[model samples]
Target: MKKGRNELLAEEEKILAPYAVSSRNSGSRAYEEPEHPYRLPFQRDKDRIIHSHAFKRLEYKTQVFVYSEGDHFRNRLTHTLEVAGISKTISKVLGLNEDLSETIALAHDLGHSPFGHAGQEALAELMKDKGGFEHNKQSLRVVQKLERRYPDFPGLNLCEETLLGIMKHGGGYETTQLLEVRRTLGPSLEALVVDVSDEITYSAHDTEDGLESGLLKLEDVKQLSIWKRIESSLPNSEKKSDLHSHSISRSIGRVLLNLMVSDLVDTTHQTLSKHKIESRESIAKAYQNKIKLVHFSEEFQKEFTELKQYLFQNLYRHPEVSRMSERGKETIYLLFKHFETHPESIPESYRKREGEDGRMRIICDYIAGMTDRYAIEKLKREGILWFPY
Candidate 1:
């Protein structure tokens, strides 16, 4: 017998924890529609995100290294996949809703500007007076109003929970933001898992990328206590040679991921116990305090903070990475400026929204949707990124 959506919902009820967000209890979308025959709301949301054009653009989007840097390095798409994987792992172990967590993780970086953070910073500076260019907000915009796939709806028509996760991605949001999700109450446990997974995936993978690129060395990362702890967890024979950088980096990432996941699960369980939160209503009430229930222990937090800071200074700020960032920023500035002067170059779809949302925002939306290669090519095509001399 082929199980249907109702069967899956029943299974979740039996399997998931009291605190988990069940599909049966999922909030309505902005525009309601009949539910799918086979997929739950969050599961359908995950599939919608996976099929979106913006999600595909992530393949050409920068992660830490530029598209021109190398083929093996992590692109935005790869990073998102890793985040999704980690989020699912954490959520499953914590007895949370894996579908919602995976959806949030996959969609978290869908609106990241081309050239990674450098491009974001450039766009932010350009839009500072106009509005702002935070990727989290941009992500919400992408799903809510930018994407045009359905005839009945303008956007993906994702469930409210998925939207909440995308909006509250990076740890903070103003009360004025995403009022639909009721900001007075904090984000769900699934959203929190995605947030932490984003941090964990990037920190470990970026270190691996830096080491692989020769921008950072084994000795360099080993200075951080977190890295040392990870290194110490490995078997003695695995420490034979530094030439095995790739394997060593993978080991380092795995160890750190395990430590973080283990701690997060333990801490979350303890928090639930302490607060006596044994039901969905209790979890919702607990969220009113705006305290994060998913987090590392104090000792782990201190060590991870030190490790993150070390990566920022050593890996992210390496001369090679900085040089790429500078070039990327220049490209973003020039492109935004050119498009500003020649609004006619804007696509008809974007132009249609200009009257309603303003030209700058439409332009930002268009640029934010571009991949790294597309942005570079567009600039070069316009003769703005090069000179005949």
Candidate 2:
């Protein structure tokens, strides 16, 4: 049986590029690891994402609340897991690479800061002269340069396809500062599914999380005509204030899943019938529109703008989170300053692996990836990293 068609499968000549992160996949795939017992190529990618310190810090990073008063709120880690799960489920149903899908989903949020975007925004503002920072770019930082367990490498050394998916997030053929999803990757087959899955997962989940966190209400959705149109286009569901977010998420998930399944299946069937192959072009056309409609809806833009403002004004810019943000920026900047001043203090392993360029970027990458709580802990234990001589 054939592994389902994707961008990689569409190439006329099967010229496999050398991927730093090898495939950790299972039975029936021709492109899986060759007799490597410790892991499959995809498994390695998934494991790298799971074991990284960035993944652990996600527990404290924001999904909605900056530093929500509750334990059950969906932190960045849980959110990533949810997105990964959704992406994996869809990828599997569509016969795409589940590990790669999960890899992209899990690592997507690694670059986000302690207070989520608020902390991220503050940091970006502080460092505006230094090329600025974006969370998606930071996720790339995590994979390529942050995790230090392997004695040398900075990142998890992920595969090219996974990297492209991480970069593109299913938007356009060009890279932009606005959304990590807009970056251009050469092929559509592999990139489309992973990127769309991220949108399908996060849009539904964030809306649910926002409502659950008391930041949004059904009334908010009900207030807008266009949103109402989109909502009416989706399935119906009962609303509970406390459970509104998850319920909306569930309702929306069903709609999204049905859309993806129907589109992929219809496209695949049509491709098989017409061209005697699973049609990447057909599925690409069908799924590409989803990026514009479901992911980039004006209704979503208005709500997210509101939410971003609310979080900054209330939750993130709130006194508590503000204190944490100050300390976070201090920790990041000071840590970088420390490395800048005393390059000798840098870990010998990291130093040996990377020269000056590696030394400089690695510190920023590591500190920027930390959550508010984790950064505070590091600060407390290590004290201010910078030493002015």
Candidate 3:
């Protein structure tokens, strides 16, 4: 087949088309028809993500603390940027669609709550009996029904491929399970890349953040059994594993970058060799690289557990935080109650079929959409929605 300008430039290697996509923005596709010159597949991916209302909320979402006393550390916004950066590098090296990876990575955390996972836990508790709340699902909601930049209804209506990639990221286990269930599973290759990229970036980046915060060091991390094995087998593991807090971020970043490029590129090449015209053969998509290996270390495993325990104790479940969180739940409840009493407050667009349950659901959706600061401010203005004395 003669390669067009938009076609992948591979001679012996069978080039994989960017996965099939239908964005939420245009509600079908943001990409220009193949005949159009201006829009491309990847560009559509970028546009859909950028246009998402959920994507915008990410600016205020938490990577760690929703309202950290300090300016340092990665908030969800910065973290998304970092994920996009690393994902793009992986895509570039492996000849994947950089825009698709970038959009998927950036949008991955779109549904995170104000106080990080703590707030999410609280919300989930409230909604456990209901359909339940996972940031990942919320992200899908945001993109599909929240963002309104375009004249189109709600979500960005991003490409199907981008949507699939987002859905599959984070070992959502949808793939492994689906494959197991039917004995045959096929997920978009972009989804697999984003998932692995997330693991790789967060593992190193979180450790880097811990080191920066004076809570951990390379030695502390090496305490992990997984890190130990990866360190032993991977070249220059000893040199890369440094305890020095200050210069180590740069070093660790380099090591992670090297590890990702090596595996993704090699696996991609291998996949290409076996590619048939019917479907694109995907890379192994396993975390056997140095990053994954190091993650399984025993000492590190204990620390990983400890880190969660520490965050819950010191940050998430603290009395002061809990007080605020409880108030958050109550406030959401009251605000929702008001909407039930006065359906006029909600936009007609959000109003679904009429009923008490439907009205309350809208109220919940509104409250859920709020940023921490915005939620607080909204409550304060509305006669101080705080916990009862």
Tell me, by lDDT, which candidate is best. Answer: 1
* RMSD of every prediction: 2.2, 8.4, 7.3
- Residue-wise lDDT of candidate 3 within 21-42, one digit each (tens)? 2221112344333333445555
Better of 2 and 3 by lDDT: 3
Q: How much lDDT does each candidate structure score?
A: 0.84, 0.55, 0.56
**TM-scores for every predicted model:** 0.95, 0.62, 0.67
TM-score-best of 2 and 3: 3
Candidate with the greatest TM-score versus the true structure: 1
- Give the alpha carbon lDDT tens digit for every residue of 1-389 in model 1: 99998898898888788888889877788897998898899988988889999999999999989888889999999999999999999889888999999999989998899989999999899999888889988888788888888999988999877887787634334455456455554678888889899998898888777777778887867777776677678767567856546877777767777888888789878887888877766766888766567888888899889989988898788888898898888888888889999998888999988889899988899899999888888877887755211
lDDT of 2 by residue, 52-88 (tens): 8878888877665544457766677777777777666
Cα shift from native, residue 199, model 1 (Å): 0.7
Instruction: Tell me the lDDT of model 3 at 242.
Output: 52
